[model samples]
Target: MGEDDDGGREVYGKMRAAAALRQIPRPPPTTFQEDLMEHLPAAIYTLLSCWTRFYQIGKNNHVVWDEAHFGKFGSYYLRREFYFDVHPPLGKMLVGLVGLLSGYNGHFEFKSGDEYKEDVPYVAMRVMLATFGVLMVPLAWYTAKELGFSNRAAHLTTIMVLCDVAWLCISRFILLDSMLLFFTVLTVFCLTRFHTERHDPFSPDWWVWLTFTGISIGCVASVKWVGLFVTALVGVYTLEDLWEKFGDLRMRKRDYINHWLARGLMLIGMPLFIYMMSFKLHFIILNHSGPGDAQMSSLFQANLEGNDFSKNPLEVAYGSKITLKNMGFGGGLLHSHVQTYPVGSQQQQVTCYHYKDDNNNWRVEKPWTLPKVDDAGEIEFLKHGDIVRLQHTPTNRNLHSHNVVAPVSKLNNEVSCYGNATAGDAGDHWQVEIVDDLVFGKREKVPRVRSLTTKLRFRHVLSSCYLVAPNSVLPPWGFKQIEVSCDKQNNPSDPHSHWNVESHWNGRLPVGETKFYKSPFLRDFWHLNVAMMTSNNALVPDADKEDILASSPTDWPWMHLGLRMCGWGDNQTKYYLIGNPAVWWSSTLSLGICVIVIAVYLARMQRGYRDWGVGEWDHFLYVCKIAGLGWFFQYVPFLIMGRVTYIHHYLPTLYFAVLMVGHLFDHFVFKSRRLKDTTKWVIFGIATGIVIGVFWWFRGVAFGIDGPIKEHWGLLWRKSWNIYESH
Candidate 1:
């Protein structure tokens, strides 16, 4: 009887195993055609079709010099811009696809020398952006489905996101903002699905959730480190998801906690890892260098290795080039060039480097600097005003009077220091040495730090020099900003250092609890720990320098209206500036409007949050805190920027303002607590009004102002593109 019973049980177990195996067999693979099943994909394709055509619009125009990304596509197969410029490559990748489909005629491959054709590239890019913009509708629909939202509401959210001008403008640009949005949306969708499937521990749902998270974050990080901000924002949502599961569930506390821990590991942690991994791999796939200086790669590697990088996270992980640890001593390579501007000088006198072999020994040769020697005739400590003359450079004698900022080399182009075999021009040769620079401090009782400048310059145009400061002031510099200038031309010895004719001016801007200085959301926000104002580093081209400088007074031609231009399409160069006044006004308005709207939202929610579950408090806190964080990361940066001259390295800060404002708009307009109709209209009016009003301020009103504005509206357009003179 026992043997018979054992046989029966074994047979039953086999039958169960077979049934489970049958149920979980591998599914069939999805075909490429399967992805384009219906109206949704078709709409996406149509939208994309327009931008692919428009991005290369100026291919045949021959009007402008064609400095855009699409115009340079044909220069290389992958068609990326210059090596060191930091721009996300996803948009360019799409442009490449368009170029391929268009028989190398779209934005990526369109261009004839320095000019472009008609509306082709622009139109193409716009359509592509529109498609991506519209596609958000369906993706949001999917998110709603996963989040248990009704089809109707999901569809509504899609429509709202699509119609937003913020979305529209971002999509239209050859930038990564839209792509970042796309990734963000994808992450939400995946996370929603994961939330629904958490109960099934042994199911394939976890893997599905993991894969989506990885893809979404990889795309997000590829576009910008700003994606990290999104990651942090979503963390609140994750905690909420975990908290909800922990309460009123069948599982014990430990089991529930484990579920959340697993989810965090799979979703957030894995996503971050995959996001960083793509930075290393994507460039190889696209055949382009990854985002500027292989930063994304090194940052992740350093974190994992935990090898000395964390000691100064500021240097290793700043968005721009900070000295990399792996880059090695004095940030590696060295003794490149020397460019110094005695406190009173903007244009510099350079002293370059050379190498000589005496008999069998080699020595690094500098310009034989004549520092202030002691009475014993030995070179000693520097003080007061002392000049070091150059041994090789001619005194820029033949420079034309009309040439306001001509290159010194142009005055002696006849000299063949370049392209000749004698000066090591045919190989990777460099001048090697180091120089120390002294800087003023701003922090209380903070002593000045030594700045070691060592680098390798192009074709061996190396130089060497030292600097001395009164050593007064505090927090001397960001250490990186220790150079003499932020402007490129003023940097006679090295191109990397920045210069600002005005940043070093004595005294600080007045600071207090003004609207601009106050934190929009949070109280007790950190004061400016350090500040470094910079000038645009873009060089004055040989052909345009004279024309640019001629627009303003000789004293500060850099402020000339003629050079203050940045526009595209219909606006062109009317009164252009890289920074649109309309945009700034809109951004500022967006902040004020956002606060007003969110405040009204929370006030209404407080009236009835008690009726809902604890989840309401979590959501409320997120909204409240982020509103403050938005100001910290965005509004505050801009307000601080306004206190000083605008600089180039601060360009990324504008993006922060734009994105935060967009989020603030999105939160109140689309996702605010289900509120009254009167509240919705009120919020909409304020936010929309502010944006429009600000836009108008930049476009129509800035040039009309008199006083300093009237004297040189032409010179200040780097702040806006279209000023009156070159006024």
Candidate 2:
């Protein structure tokens, strides 16, 4: 009976997909309307191809690695689980489908330091993302069309995104960054439909508008948290919708608000609900592990607040709360019962029965966990602060990091035994705590210790939550200490700030490893594109330190790049020149294009109209050309000449360029419907003089010693650029 149902479902799914495929026109893989990929300038294509390859096999799934710590498909799969598994499931599903189609569902273990040789899944994932990449042409084209750009401008926009190395690199990767670009651009396109739609709620386009808007937003959030930024952009559109859709007809504000509310409920609300549901059901599937402990803690507190999980043990035990908080970082508290710390009490520390130590310097020792948990099993909680200990293996073994080979190589006491060829005693480098078995019984809140004395008790686990310690796999950034003790009796302020931590290693635990980036979505590559007097820009000294001293566990978005292949360290070798580098010089170049749009708009805007040439076509074009010079300067250097992504030096070049673009646009729009050529030239001269002459005069501040234009700057560019240099 079950087999029959399964077969029926499979047939139905294929039928649905086939129908979807049939509904759309399948043009041969040919270029239409001057695409970025197909119709791009050859130089642009070459750059994009190189970047796409970088993104495809650069940082995420296709990373270069030391022979001891590399895993390809397994690493990819583990990253999905360790990180949030929202939209990547589709990509994973595609991978699984490709695997099944190729009839290699089982593992074909490779020799040491070998790469996976499968081409089908690679081709499938890359082609799928590539197809989306190609789709970007139409999407950007339609966006320009929505904005009412001329055939020339709209077509150019398509070329820009297509030729863009950022877009190309993302396309080559097997993750959600490119997908996110697709969804966001798609949302903007759908929003254009709303913008162009008339005021009438009864119009046929209303339903279609709502459908596209809602689904696009839904899918946007499904890709990653950054979707919220687009969602906000949508709300901005909603406000503008009143001005665009209703403005032409002179509809009252009330009518505009009411009509949009109705459409918004259908479009915005429904899709958001669906996107959230994806997470909820997934949490239900992954019922055990440390999250259960958190859920129980929340449930226990909820019981105190009136709602108890005891009523339906199934509901209580079955699922975690669907919150972004879960995806963020939160590792429970730490206590020492066996005298792990000074002035410690065993009873106060023994909130949970088991405590395992993954720290090298030995903060806490084990019996660190409870009994094991099965896939669907869950550990129960008696009350808040019930104090459970860890006792489980992680579903995300990829993040388990490397199996420890030499415990002697292990700094301090931390160890993950890399067993011999036999797989026996395979090292204990990492310890995963399961919430299910060790024990969850009620306990009294005590007064001896502040932890137990508190009204709120927590499910403390022995595993190192990112909140407690960073992964030891990557290079260490800034430093921190857990136990900073101050004289409480003499201090009246926060202790951590004033605590005199002995600089020696005597009492401090070994510095835990900072987690290596497991996905392309999160990378610690902040390109310091500082703007200098609009003439030059420079990268910051700590460009490689993406989030070294980040405030929280999640701030280290090392895993945020998700699964991109855009390289590990953000390159910054391009901003040494005085003028603008090329667009590919840095990811920050996207801001440069934005500057161009606003410049064109300001130079000829008619109050709130979309027409770029509303007041004066030639003048607007002139301003646009100047603005284009900035981009030309920006891109030409990077493109024709080989350079890299550096923002600080590039910023000075960009700053004045941006202001000129902006002021030129604003001046033309606000100054008048028609102005004299003399007046235009005067304004242009003033803008140019203040930007250029002033920069040249105070060149030191604007373009430091080794800035783009600096003739022979000192050691400014050579500081803090390498990962191996000790601070």
Candidate 3:
């Protein structure tokens, strides 16, 4: 009786399984129409983006705003000449590549407001750069889809990106902003792709997306230092992800170790390799010496073609023609010009210049009143405590100082070139005080000054002042060079007071060995990166002078002001960089809405209200974290940055805010069960209409305005915008 009962139960279970299997329906085959419909939104956005970015791109043939700068950098690349700039090389390399493909020979100087010559190919280059902007709309749409947004939310994201006027204006010109924006969006997109493959970790697809994410990180950072903000976002996300895995009790020790190894190799190691490779390529391409040679170390400049540092004498001696260089970080060559100071002693101006020229050459000679050294006499090596006069080789003026105040540094005495070769006074004397020696060690009784190694200071014999070149820049009359003054107080620790013989020439001494001047690639790389950061940080606003175009970071999100991209002359074509009000205001509002919504949800959860399923709650938190944190990382740093910022600096941050808008719409209206599908579609339509209408209304500000500015009165939606010419 027991065997019969068991048989009956097994038969009943088999019958139930067969019935369930028969009830399951097969998926329908994908058709061409269905696939086209699926991709139609991105395709449409791409088309619109191309239209907005490329339409009348060449209407203004004159170099506009930063095009004067970035276009010249591209020319430098094509000419294979080294030039120094605060930005990294990848974006400029791309610009050069565009010029090469368009048949530009790097002949055009691209002076601001200068009309492009017939052979410059400015239009084609602009068109190529605008392609990056053209791809941005589709990238945003696809990124939204990867983040699990509904179709309605994805479409809204695409429209918002497409309709932003400032993004459009920046892309249509020759600048790095477009490339920076594209790479930033690409990084986020790749990150979302990597996240979706977490369930199948260590698989081929997972590794591919992860590697792509790393490459994108490298590419973005190589364009600008601002790219680090997005990199930081990626870093935070990775840390959170690894922390979650660490908390998983089911994970094996070997698997966890493997995860750490993989991330270290692919994320940190790969991006660093890519960044270093860009600098390596930059050094290779720019082998010729150009205007920026003085900005680099003497050793690094020695390796460049056309540089004469390799031919320099090994040691400094009396009667040697030399250029003195400040040993401070990012310092320049001690220079003097024929122009006299408008204020102070009214003598020939002494300054620090970052370019190699005849003005930088000075001859080390005995005090003007002393007997001239014989040519055939035994060489008198310049040593510690030597009294000498640095005669301006071009003008034959002795380096002199007086009690008159300096033009910039008022506390310091004025340093100028006074007496000529024949005329002389006691003020012409300078005592050479050796600080230390890099090669020969500390000061010796007969210590010879080694070129490029021995640090020295010139003290005014009569005034007891140390000649110094501080970081203070002179006024426009002095060509905006670093100010040179005579310090009344002695300070051995100040690098600004330190000087070294950078370039020496004497018939008596032999050329230095190449081994002595070899600068390692890693050291040069580190030095250049630090110098760039230092220079970038020095770009703060001046309280004494007003810059009409400058705006505070607080003024960005609210659209308080807009920038005039070029001249406002009635005869010239112009562009105004302002955002579409509907998009910027709504996106900013979404940030506040996000904070309130998260708080309310947490309160409800505390009260035991289950508003969402487990998977839904997790998804909501994930998307919100990426959007909020991405915005935070990109924007909050600007508040503390000492550098002067423009509205365009906020462009990358705006992308994250726009993402928040899409996520909120998906969670509250589109995908929510509380909202009907008809209501969701209606709301999406109204939002899209507002965005498109505002963009159309302000489209001329980007596409280019012809004729008089007074004709385009409605372009200034905000009262503070400088779009209109002053009456």
Per-model TM-score versus the true fold: 0.44, 0.43, 0.85
TM-score of 3: 0.85
What ranges in model 1 sit over 4 Å off? 1-82, 87-102, 105-114, 117-130, 140-157, 192-207, 243-261, 282-326, 329-339, 343-727
Indicate the TM-score of model 1: 0.44
Clashing pairs in 3: none
Q: 1-727, model 1: which lDDT tens digit per residue? A: 7655775656766764553343322325557676445346336533543343233332223322223543343233344321222333444455555445444443334332333444345445434544554455456556544543333334333433433333434444333445566666666566556555554653787668756765676566555544545455456556765665554334478877776676667656776565444433333433343222222222222222212323321211001112211111111111112233232222332211111111111111122232221334422221112121111222211100111221332221111111111122211122222222212332222222111111212212222221111111111111111121112232334423211110010011121111111111111000000110111111212342244422222112122232232322332322223334433444446556656866776787778643334344343344334434523442233333322222222222333334334455444455556776577667666654554544444432212122334443333436533444333
For residues 486-541, what per-residue lDDT tens digits would candidate 3 score against the true structure? 99999988888999888899988898853355667887787678667756765777
User: In terms of TM-score, which candidate is strongest?
Assistant: 3
Q: Go through the candidates in order and give each one's C-alpha lDDT.
A: 0.35, 0.33, 0.87
Instruction: Report the CA-based lDDT of candidate 1 relative to the real structure.
Output: 0.35
Compared with the true structure, the alpha-carbon lDDT of candidate 3 equals 0.87
Ranking by lDDT: 3, 1, 2
Model 2 per-residue lDDT tens digits across residues 1-727: 7645775566756654553343222224545755554335434434543443333332222322211121223233322221222132333333333344444332433233234455324444444555555565566656554544444334334444544333444355344445566676677678656655543365678668767888887776665444545566566545644445453334467876777776668667867675655444333332333212221122222222122222221111111111100111221122122222122221111111111222211111122133332325543322322332221121111011121121112322221212221122211222222212101222232211111111221111333211111111111111111221111122122211111100112111223111221211111010000001100111112345564321221211111111111122233111111221122222243345556665766765646655533324433443344334433443334333221233221221232233233433344432445876567556545543443443333233211122232243341322322222222
lDDT (C-alpha) at residue 646 in model 1? 28
Worst 10 residues of 2 by lDDT: 526-535
